[model samples]
Target: MRTVTRARLLIVCLLSLRYGGHDEPAAQSHGLFCASADAHPTPFILRFRKTDRAVILPAYLDHIFDAAAAIERKNARRYLYTNNNDSWEETPFNHPSTFDTLALDPGMGERIKADLDAFSKGESFYHRNGRAWKRGYLLYGPPGTGKSSLIAAIANYMQFDIYDLELTKVSNNADLKSLLMQTTRKSVIVIEDIDCSVKLSNRDGADEASEKATDSNTSCKLTLSGLLNFTDGLWSCCGEERIFIFTTNFKERIDLALLRPGRMDMHILLSYCTFHAFKKLARNYLGIQEHPMYLELDEAMRKTSIQLTPAAIAEILISNQDSPDVAIREVLAAFPKDMPNERAGNVDGGKCQLSHNESKQQTFRQTMFVFFQKTKHLR
Candidate 1:
């Protein structure tokens, strides 16, 4: 005979047991068995005490949730903080930038990679020192010097998602903290153009401060104190294994309080392009291991130090890549034609090798033109 039952009765009994009621079991006591389509075993949850919670809740979560699955496969995601219904919106991040591909000095790039590796593996060290498991990086460089690309490379190398926090978009300190709270572990919190993001109270401009000054509820002023708290305060301990990145074009504009070693940590300067960086670009663009023009390029760069940016130089290489010889000459031309290095460029004791290079350049241009004409006719 099937006996009728009610959910209220089950809840009443469970509540009675949970609240220390010594009610005797009903004669027709029944047990609830919950199951799912998932194959993993689900532990039966009966009590409401924290002891049971400590033992069983996390085990249940571990069975169902896999936070590190994507990270293990080197496929992390990117998240942007938003002021809409949700705090952050997520998307798959698959940036191809790596240490090898960056147009940065090889030595500097390697050191940065090593630093990232050490931080990722420094869980024990952080815990031992009684510090939160977070690292801060300050990338300061002029525009087009690959600050954004470096961030992408860091994310790819570390296998961590990027959480790009826009301070200007945030209404106030409380909002900022809330946004940080929603961010998951093993993620990068990047604030690009920090100097341009917000004109905080401690910095310049009384007019800007007056504009930001408003009721805390409707429009709260985001202050330097709040930003510092977001970086290193108790509220910042919401998650573990986070990375904070602040990038700026003008480091001088930023307040000193934010640039301290513990707060900003490593301050990396992505300065103007070096000849070593040009070689990396050549390898990537022209597929060349060695070239005579390499010496000329180096000599030209060394003469009073050409301040061409990596992006600007890379553009020349990328555009003229079809003709490698022409590309090399163009890059050399980009630098000042100061006296040629005797050993590197010229054979006749430090005289300019313009005639020789011009002759080669003319021949290559003719060859490309002839080849293109023939191909055009054939087509």
Candidate 2:
């Protein structure tokens, strides 16, 4: 009986081994269920019931990680990224401007806000429509017209990062592309005074310059075509939810390519301060929407041919903050007598259109001019 039992056990073992060779091992069927590090260094579990299941696991994990990252970015505080050595670096983004504080035309502000809201919520819509999830804005105005301030206000309103792209620092088209790729989604890529930064000329002029430079062994050349490609090329669609803002005092100097319909989605002309804008400034600075002197100030602004920038008006109001009446009177008195129809000529076309530092000097000149005129009249 013992010999028979041994023979049966041997036969069963052989049968089991033969079947196992044809079928998968139990371990193979169960798969290696364990935690593994993802590309982002986040640990996640890997479980599989079949050999073919692992094929889809990486893609599944990637989707989950992407979703998580998108949520994190949406909630995270905004950053001000600057380019350094062809890479991006983050810095604390502390911009104090908001939509409420910004002195813009009521209708214009509302339109911009509406557009921003649509863009933020229309991810699926953009995909369905086969349109790039991006928007471009061209802000053209004189110095102190609040172009930079408007940018800050938009950034604050959208809770988006600001990538102040300094074209002069960039080496070439390749460097520009690299810098743009490094930028994350939901950020503003600003090229302030684009015309001044590079020689934004017609296609013929750019080609001629490129040809000359190719012959001469010069350093990196930034051509108009390269810039347009950077803004609206196929690579520009690599990232999503981005805003391209270009500011220039001389809109006429900007290349026609940039002004084309689809290139700059919106052409915003931030002209001189209107009475409506002044009312906003008054409410912001003096905390009074309707003061006794508002009518007089409105009349004064209407009668004056000079177009005062929001910055110039803001300085006058803040200077005499202690007394609302004094501030209003001072602002009214400061209106330039020579309301030249062409103040654009005063701006240095070769330099930055309207820098913050230059705004102060311009405001000082405006104030001093008004002060001198007033003093002379008193005498």
Against the true structure, whose lDDT is highest? 2
Angstrom error at residue 175, model 1: 0.4
Report the lDDT tens digits of candidate 2 across residue range 66-89: 777766766788888877748888
TM-score of each predicted structure versus truth: 0.67, 0.69
- Ten-residue stretch with the least lDDT total in model 1: 8-17
> What's the lDDT for residue 191 in model 2?
92
* Count of clashes, each model: 0, 0
Global lDDT for candidate 1?
A: 0.68
Which TM-score value belongs to model 2? 0.69
lDDT (Cα atoms) of all candidates against the true structure: 0.68, 0.72
